[model samples]
Every structure is written in C-alpha cells, then in structure tokens.
Target: MAAVEECVVVIDGANVACQKDGKVHIPKLAAAIKYFRSLELAAGRYPVNCVAFAPNFWLNVKPSPGSAGPKENGTMETDDWALLNQLVHQDHVILTPSQAHDDFYVIDYAVKYNGFIVTNDMFRDHVSNKRIFHGKRLTSNWVRSHCIDFTFVGTEFMPNPRTMERVVHFQPSATSAVTTSSLHDSNDNDVEAESDDVQEDGMVVDHKGTKRSKTIDLSEVTYYKVPRELLPMLHGEGGETMGKFQEYTGTYIVLPSHAASAAPSTSNVLTLSIYGPEPSRLQAVGHLDAFLVQMQQQYAYQHQQQYMASQVHQAGMYPHQHQPSTGTQDDQMMEIDPY
Candidate 1:
C-alpha cells in the first residue's frame, strides 16, 4: 500500500474576521501552517499543501493601480463561505470549518467525501432532525454526526494556545484497492457470488474482486437539536468550562442560561463553552502535536530507507549467490528475486 499523504490546510480568508486593530484573529489557520511546516522540516515528509481564498472583492482590488481587477465580486458573503467552496474540490484530510453561518457547506462536503467536519458550532447538534432537502434527508444520526461532529474521524477537540476550547481533528475517507487476479474471474462465478450475497450500503467492489464495507450500529448513534438564537454563545467551549462540560451526557452541550448573558472580559477571551469526550485542553493539544510529529518522523524514516535501498541497488550490492552468469539456456531459466 502507498503511504498516506500529508493533510491539506485550507484557510478561509473570508471567515477570518479582522479585529479593530486591523489584524486577522484566526489562530486555527496559524496552528495548521505551523503543524504542516513541522512535517516538512522532518525527513521524508509528504507534501502538505495550503490554499487560501478571500472574497472576490479582495481579489478585485489591485495591489497597484496599473494591475487588472478581479473578474467578479460578491460571490461569497464571508471568508468562511469562500473557504467552503474551496474545500468542495479537495479529496482528502479533515476539513476545519469556522463557526459561521449554519456551516451547511461543511455538512455537504462531509456527506460527499464520507469524511469528517471539524467546527465549534453548537447548532451542529440539530443534525439529527433527518429533514429532507431537495427530496433527500439523512435518516441516521451516524450520517448526521459524521457530517457535523468535531471529532468524527477519531478524537475531537484538541487544545490551542489562543483559545481555552480544544480544536478538532478531521479525517478523510479511506481508499480501497483491488487486485489484478480478481478481474479475471469467470462471469458465471461473479454472477453466482452476486446472487448469494446482496451488497449493503457503504460497500464497494474493487477491481481485484474485493468487497469493502462499513457496518454502522444505529443503537449507538445519538442526535441533538439546538436552537439558532443561542448558537453564538454556544459556539465553542472555553478552558474555564472544559472540565465541567466534557462530563456532560448529551451528544451536544450548551452554555448555561445565565452564562449566555455574560460578556467576555476581553474581546480576545473566548466566550463559548463546548463539552466533548476529552476533558483537558492542554493535553489534547499535546496529543495532536505529538501525532503530527510522529507522522513527520515516520515519513522521514521511510524516505531514508528508500534512499538507502536505492543506493544499494545502484552499487550492485544486492545479494546474489552465483558467480556472474554467462549466456546459456540454464542461466536464462534461473529465477532471481529483486529486492
């Protein structure tokens, strides 16, 4: 199997709100870049690419008066929306959506890729409604959760130096492969196999005649519905409430009634509180950082090993038991294993 490639970090320039100080306040974007760079610095790191898109308006404005302007404007209202459109074309990794709008684009992408969506939006709880749109509605919370949960891929919620609430980890769908032998099977056998076993949902038949499927247990899934008005205050969990909230029972957690009315001491202070599986924010961040470091190291090691193998092959040092062979029928028939 081929090695897993590095994750792509897509920055939503529109969702990046500018503060009164004229600086963007997106620590998530910064963290992503830092993590990716760390991987590159390690040996044999897969490429970690980044793409950023702002409002067409930003693209329209010329750096110099003589430059041409952007072709269109107002295609997207906010940076978050711009980012969502950019993510639609991507094929892998966890997609981190900002807590803006309903984050419908995030949900749509998750469903399409069978990937995870990472966000701090409290309204994500409402994903269980199973409401149909354009004639289709998700019947299972597992599907809904996969579309909305912060940690759908594995663990959700890691720590950030800038925020008390933990960040999320998103994972892409797994790729399956087929073998050459499977494709050559007789049609009669294929028909008999198809008749004996029905294909289930989320199952794929590979070119090599291998069947891959994911079995989801409906009993284990839970769905929560949250009101829209309270969304902003319930957007993200704060460090102060991390302990209390993480212990809560519901699939989703909201701020206490009184807590919603309170204002942040400073604009920089996170006002929302989100509760989830892991309790400690710092520990979560440390774990994620460690995972990234490990991946980087693993990639480096693999590259080194491959380089060494190549060198050995080039030097003609690969093991051979015989003296150099001469042209002969017996020599031509002799089998050798290439390492």
Candidate 2:
C-alpha cells in the first residue's frame, strides 16, 4: 500500500470559539481541534497538523464571577481556561497582535503550509470583492478548493462530510499546485462563483444585493501626498494601520521601504502610491488623508492646551482665580488659533 500524505490545516480560532450558542465556547473549539488531529492519513497514522490562530483579546478571556448571565457569555469557564492554557503551552495556538485582525494570519498560514482553512466565514470581504493580496486575488475558486467549513451535531463537532471527503481525495496536479503563483495565474481568467448568481453580461450578484464584475483590472495606480511626520502613525506598529486600510479598501499601499521609513527624509512631505482598481485606490487615499488630518487636529489641540497652561503659570494665576470681567463675553474669552 502506498503511504498516505499528511495534510496541514489552519483553524480560525475566533470563528470556532463562537460556534456554539453564539458565544465563546472554548470546549467546542477544543473538540474541533481534537477531532481534526484524530483524523487518520493512513490506517494507523494520524497525519493532520492542525493549528489555530486567534486575535490577542481571546487570550485574556477571564471568567467574571457572580454573574447572572450564561457561562458562554464571552467569558471562559475554569475548565475552558485550563484547556486554552494547555493548547497555548503546546504551541498549537497563535495569538496575533491585538492591534491587527487575525484574518491575514489565518490565510497566511494556509498559504505557507499549502494547507486548508477551516472556518464558517465566507471571507466575503476578501474573496467576494476579488481583493488582491500579495499580487494575487483571493478568487472564489481558490477559496472553494482550499477552505473547509464545519458544523455541530449536538455536542459533537466535525468538518462538513462532503468537504472532508473532497479534501481527503485531493491531489495536486502537475500544473495546478495551490501556491501563490498558481493562484495569481488562475485569477486572470476567474470562473464564476457557484454560490453567486451570474448575469448574462458577466456580472455577479451575491445574496447581499452587492454587484461586482467577474473580472477586475488591478493595474490602476494613484498617488497622494502626506506630511512626513505622520508616517509612523499611518504605518502603526508592525504596519497594522496600513494593513487594515488595505484589507478594508482592497488596495495595496506602497510606502517607503523599511530603511527609508525609519530614516528621516529631507523633504517635509512623502507620497503614498496606492495600487488597485480606480475606485479602490480613491477610497484608500481618501481614508489615509482623513487619518492624517485627524492626527494633525489632535496635535494642534494638545499644543493649544499646553500653551494655555504655560500662560496661566507665567501669570501666577489659577484658572479659577480669574475675576469676572465687565467686558462682553467675547472680550473675556481668549481665542487660540489652530495651527
């Protein structure tokens, strides 16, 4: 008998956590993981490597005491906490940074391992809009071929039987390997999604009443200027800010490289090069400019407050000590111009 190949799997921890009772049921999630690990690749060999990724908030899910609500009300029970701790210690769980979403990490691990993703999420935000990431659009065909959804039968949790059957029988073809490159090439001629209704004119209408073209042109590029001082805030720690913007807008933002980002530039302004469809690029630039404006306004507000405090101290007078003036209200009020 030929040896069966081992399979790698990435589980969406948050999606599994809320599977039971619409709350964070750690035991249900643990059961799903245990079930996946128990699946046999050979007669006696369990060849499943299942890893779960979650946002950092779930790591601190402490149970509240003396609560009238149910145990699964977004709080971990004692046993649940213990099980979660064991999973963490075993290195089976990856808690992503709190400032970022776990979607990227989940998809990344799936791609890195050439594995399958188990989640109920349609990934509409990612696949539906034909969003491009890392030079490839997450096409529906790729998602359908690589992702798995699950269901619960009372207290038992398991992946969908049909999907599991397909997964177990899947064999990568010589020219159809599920890699970044294959996915990129496959998206050039996208097959219409089975779940969506397609019109004769090559447009797809999803259940949510949103319409999108069957094909998109990702060659469009646009640029916008920003103050150099606000670059760090725009990037955020580990580039989470810009990453979120890309995820939301479905556009890839090209900023300075690592060395250039860190070094102070002689120019007071920097340019942001956004790449995607025309509407997506416009949306990204608009949001980026809005964030910069908000930060600038906040800085101006802080500066004004500091100046007022310094002026009061220099006059040796407290704010409350100011006597009422006989002048009009406008004359008594001090106006500070914004920067």
lDDT of 1 by residue, 50-87 (tens): 33333322222222221153323322234434333344
Error of 2 at 337 (Å): 13
Give the Å error, residue 164, model 2: 1.2
Whole-model lDDT per candidate = 0.32, 0.64
TM-score of each: 0.25, 0.57
Model 2 CA lDDT for position 255: 66
Off by over 4 Å in 1: 1-30, 33-102, 125-339
TM-score of 1: 0.25
The segments of candidate 2 whose C-alpha lies over 4 angstroms from its true place after superposition are: 1-4, 19-22, 42-46, 61-63, 66-79, 129-135, 170-182, 186-327, 331-339
After best superposition, candidate 2 residue 227: deviation in angstroms?
18
Question: Backbone clash tally for model 1?
Answer: 10
> What is the per-residue lDDT of model 2 for residues 11-105, given as tens digits with 9 covering 90 to 100?
99988887445446677778878888887654534377788987665656455332354563345555666777788888888887543447767
Candidate number with greatest lDDT = 2
